[model samples]
Target: MDAPYGQLIEAEPGVARLLAPNPTPYTFTGTQVHLVGRDELAVIDPGPADAAHIDALVRAIGGRPVAAILVTHTHKDHSPGARPLSATTGAPVVGCAPLVIEGGTEAGFDHLYAPDRVLADGESVVVDSRTLTAVHTPGHTSNHLCFADEAAGILFSGDHVMGWSTSVVIPPDGDMGDYVRSLEKLRGRTQDRIYYPAHGEPVAEPQRLVRGMIGHRLQRERQILRRVEAGDRTVERIVAAAYPGLDPRLVPAAGASVLAHLLELAKRGLVSHADEQWSATA
Candidate 1:
C-alpha cells in the first residue's frame, strides 16, 4: 500500500512486490505480483493482461533473468499477464493445473490460462537462492496454490488466505469444505512465519491469523445454519438474513458464498435442499 503502483518494493531481504492497478471490490487495492529472488526471480501472480502492467513488470525485472512465472490460480485478475510476460522474458509459465469451468468467465476466471509446466503439490522450482514449493490449496478456485519458501519461512499465500477479507468460495469449482480444510492445512504449517498474500499487507503472524480465519468460517457456517433454522430456504434469503446491508455490488458474490456453505452443509447431512429450498436435517 505504501508503495505506488508498478514499482517493485522489497518486503524482506529477497522478497519484493509490485502492485497492479486493477483494484475492485473483490480485488482489494490490486493483485500483488511477488518477486521471490534477488537475482534470477520467480514472478508470482503476474496479474491482468494489461499492457501497462506487463511493461511495468518487465521494467521491474530490470534485465534480470526470470526463472519462472508462477500463477496461483487462473482467475482473470491473477493469471492473464503470465502469457504476455513469459513471451517478453522467455520465462516459462508454471504452477497450478489448468482449469476452465463453463459459465465461470463472468465470475473472473481466465479460461485461457495455460501453464507451461504444472507443479504438482509439494513439487518445487528452484530460483537463484530460493526454492518455492507449490502447496495445492483448492478453495478460492479448484487449482489455487500457495508457494512456500520453507527455508525462509515465507509463504506466498495467494487468494487462499488474505489479510483484507475472507475469500469468496463460489460453488461448483469452489468448495467451502475444501476452503476450511485448506485453512487447516496452512494452520498446521507451524514453520511459515510470514505470509505475503495476493492482496493486502504481509501477514506477520500467519498462524494466529489462520486460526482466527478458521473460527470466522465456522461462525459463518453457524450463521447460515441459524438462517436456515429461521425459515431462510434459498441462498438469496439466507444471504439477506446472514449478511444484512451488504453492498448491492457484492450481493452476488455473497450469495455464491452462502450457496457454498449450504452445499457443504448438505454434504455433512446437516441441511437438505428440495426445489431450491433448504432446511435443517435431522
Candidate 2:
C-alpha cells in the first residue's frame, strides 16, 4: 500500500495538502497545510529540516503570506526547520520551549527552535476567520499540544495521536501517566470531526480511535502486571513476555513502553523495582 503522506485528500473545503514526503523514516509522513477560508494560512508541524520539504511548502503556499508557524513539540523530526522557515516567511514560530538535552546527549537540533510565541492550553489564535485553539495534550512528549480549528472542526494532532502505529512512551520525556490522561481529555472534547495527525492518513472516527488507544494501553499494563505475577522480575523479561509478537527491530521501543508502565506501577505502589528488576509489591 502507498504511504499516507503525499496522498492529497481534502481535509476541509479550503484546506488542501501540500503533502509531506513519505518514507522519511523520522517523520515517515509529512504535511504542509493551506487554509482557504481566510486568506491567512498557517503551516503546522513542518516536517524535518529538509531543504526540499521547505521548498515544497513555499511552492504550495504560492506566495500566500504564512501568518504563523505552529509546532506541537520539539522532536528533531518535527521542529528543526522552524527557524529557517520562519525566517523565510517572516512568520513567528510558536510552541513549547525547545526540548532540553541532558547527560551528554546533544540537543536533537530541536533546541535551536526559539518559538516567538508560547502557546498555553485553551489559548486561541485567529487567522482570518478560522480560530485554532491550543489543547495541551502531553504524552508522546512532555511538550506536545494539539490544535483544534473551530471553523473546520478539525484537530491537527501531532504525535499525540496518529493514524498508524501507537506512539512510543519513552521515559524522562514521555510519560504514560500523562499519555493516558491526555487520551481521556480528548475523549471529552466536543469539536473534533477529523484528525490530521503528524503521521499516517487523517482519522475520521476520533472518539473511537481514542478509545481503542486507551484500551490498548490498559491491556498492555495488565499484561505487564501479569508477567510480574508470573515470576518475571525485570523490565526486559516482562517486555519479552508481554510483547511476544513485536518486531525485533522495535524491541528497544517496546522496552521503553515497558519501562513507562513499570514506573507508573511503582508510583502507585502496585509494583516495586530494585537492583534493576521489577516485582509485584501489592
Candidate 3:
C-alpha cells in the first residue's frame, strides 16, 4: 500500500487516515492515524509525538469539534501524540489503560501516556453518535486495545493484528498464549467486516487473516518444541534455528519472541527452561 505521508486519505465513508512519517522495519509504512466520524471526529492512534505529524492532523481536522483522541496502546509510536493533539483540539484523551512496565521502557513504550478515561473490554464510548467499543485485546501489550465501530462494521485493530507481519510477543508483558487467545477472540467475532491496523493496509478479510495468524503461532510453537527436543536449548539457538538468516537488526527481538514462546510452552508443561536453557518436557 503506497500510503502518502501527511495526506488525509479517505479509507471508507466517514473514515480517513494520515500516515505518520515514522516508517521502519517494525512500523512498515509508519503509523496510520485514523480519523473516525464526519463532523465530530475521534482521532485514533495519533502516532509519535512528531510536531509535523501533529500539525498535519490539526490541518486535517480543520477546526472541527473533536469528540475524542482515542489510543490503541501506549507504545511510543502509537500514543505520544495524543496529549499534543488533545491539547490542540481540546478533545479528551481516552482508550487503553496507561502502562509503564519497569525495565520495559527500552521497548518503545510511552511512559507519559495519561489517558483521561480508560475504556475496559466491551465498554463503548459514544463519539458523534457512533458507539466505538473497546476490545481489550492484550498480548501485543498488556493494555493494548482494538476499537470497534459495530454500526460501521469497522475495527481499528492496533498492533495486535497487523497485515504486514505477525506481532512480536516479548515476555514479561507480552505473552504468546494471550496473543493467540486474542487472535481467537477476534476470529469469533464474525461481525467485524474490515480491520484498519495502525501500521499497515486495512484487512478486508480479517477472519481469514486472524485464523492464519493463529495457525502460524501454533506452528511456531510446534517448531520451537521440536527445536528444544533436539537440544536447541537457548533463546539464541532457538531463534537461529527457527528464524534462519534473519536480519541482524531484528535478532534481539526474535530472541525475545522465542523466550515468550518458551515461557508459554513451560506453562503447558510442554517445555521447561532451567538456568536459561530450554528443553522439551513432554
- Report the Cα RMSD per candidate: 1.3, 2.3, 1.2
- The 10 consecutive residues of candidate 3 with the worst lDDT sum are 100-109
TM-score, cand. 1 vs. native: 0.97
Residue 197 of model 2 has an lDDT of: 83
Q: Which regions of candidate 2 fall more than 4 Å away from where they truly are?
A: 1-9, 22-38, 101-109
Q: By descending TM-score, how would the candidates be arranged?
A: 3, 1, 2
lDDT of 1 by residue, 1-282 (tens): 553899999998889999999999999999999998887999999999999999999999999999999999998989999999999999999999888676645457887888899999999999997899999889889899999999999999999999788899997899999999999999999999999999999999999999999999899999999999988889998888888899999998999999999999999999999999999996
Residue-level error in angstroms, candidate 3, position 195: 0.2
Task: Count clashing residue pairs per candidate.
Answer: 0, 1, 0
Q: List the residue pairs that clash in candidate 3.
A: none
For model 2, residues 167-257, the per-residue Cα lDDT tens digits are 8888877889999999999988767888888777788999999999999999999999889989999878887888778778788788889
Q: How are the candidates ranked when ordered by lDDT, highest leading?
A: 1, 3, 2
Q: Against the hidden reference, what TM-scores do the models get?
A: 0.97, 0.91, 0.97
Quick one: best lDDT, which candidate? Answer: 1
Model 1, position 78: C-alpha lDDT score:
95
Clash count, predicted structure 1: 0
Candidate 3 C-alpha lDDT tens digits along 235-271 = 8888999998899989978988888889999999998
